[model samples]
Target: MSDDHASSSDTTAATPAPRSLDDALALMRDLRARCEWDRVQTHASLRPYLIEEAHEVDDAIAQGDDAVLRDELGDLFLQVLFHSVVAEERGAFGMQDVAGALIAKMHARHPHLYGDGVKRSWESMKAAKAKRSTLEDGLPAGLPSLHRAHRLQDRAAGVGFDWPDALGPLAKVREEVEEVASLIDPATGAVTNQDALEAELGDLLFAVVNLCRKTGVHGALALDRTNAKFVRRYATMERLAQADGKTLSTLTLDEQDHYWDAVKAEERAG
Candidate 1:
């Protein structure tokens, strides 16, 4: 072979294709070594980025953008490694420690994988795992209240503490809504009792979340999708108004409603 070709072959042979986890770790280590922003980041500094990256990954998944999803997922994993690195520096835990803990936990939870016998189904295995976890173990307090409640309900349900069907939760939701309306005292146009109003509102929200839990719907994600759709539709309305030489705020309520209806029709038609 020619000298240049032999040199290229030697280089290719020396560099092995990395396993997925190993490639991820190597990139993380390289960032910590050479990236200025990454080098200075501590767990506290990376907290917001961790949440942001996670949301970005979710967005990519929803949009079905494989390249963007892969990149966002890597960013999310980097945050995990960053936190582990900081913890390691503080003598708390390292990457190996994190991996070991997760592996041990998974093995312990999956008795089908490492215990009595093979699991017949994933549902039964999940139930077994939930029974093994404490009340606080399955649901983090820091999660959004709706999400936390759903998770808490699921865990509780695994232990036989749940509504029998959607009908029961639906009835409870209606009762809570009625109590909230009663708190308003519509004739006065004022909340004569603030405590009653607040209590009723809380109860109503809790009941709605319970209904969602029973119906296998995620209240938080449902709200998030609606919020995103509203923003997009409103932006389209604003652009249409601006193109027609008008400010959205200056338009009459009826005129704005007309534009909103048009936008809704367009979206539906599309």
Candidate 2:
């Protein structure tokens, strides 16, 4: 009599190693068919994962490690597969449609590359076909503030509404800073009108973001670098305090400053 237990061949049949894009899509399909979590996921339900995976890919890219970046990119591609499968289940579209649409758009965007034509600006071609009545027509509200500001400014610049150079944005940044300063109470050194202060602060930050764009600097990336630098220096300060038989919490401002200054001096010397 034949045994009912699963053998190595049976296990191999159940779990397959994907060898290509088609194999990956088939693997995703199999997961949806068998896994309860994957089976129940809808496009709307998977939206957050889509956003999170994109950010993880960004972080991996910033880390400058090819292996990690490749892994993150694969995770991001899984989101694409997930959405495509969900769409296919609903009879909306399939992965082939998704890939076909991308290829069509790329070909249309670069007629010179795919057809017999002169090189033309893809944005201008898109604008001709796109019925965008406002500058923020295509910009999503959920975009990061700094990136949104940069995109909005770029759109305005395309229509001849922007300043010619960095000097104009620099001047606007100074003006916005002064307005924010005026909102603060000089005596108490605190803002009394919270609403007005917030509005002024928004203006100041928007101006600064615009200045960053004008100067060819990425505001979010610049802030990310500063955040990392601060964390590194703060950790070094804590370590220095610990070595001196003190906890960071027990150290006074002067004591903390001694360690902070030492860290900075060492960094400069190194």
User: What's each prediction's TM-score?
Assistant: 0.72, 0.81
Global lDDT of each candidate: 0.75, 0.81
Candidate 1 lDDT by residue in tens digits, 26-133: 766776787776677777766667777788788878888666666666667767777887787789988999999999877766767788766544434567756655
- In the range 117-188, model 2's lDDT, one tens digit per residue, is 877666566667786987688888799988888888776666566778999989999999889889888898
Which residue pairs in model 2 clash with each other? none
- Model 1, position 144, has a per-residue lDDT of 85
Candidate with best TM-score: 2
Error of 2 at 179 (Å): 1.6
Give the candidate number with the greatest lDDT.
2
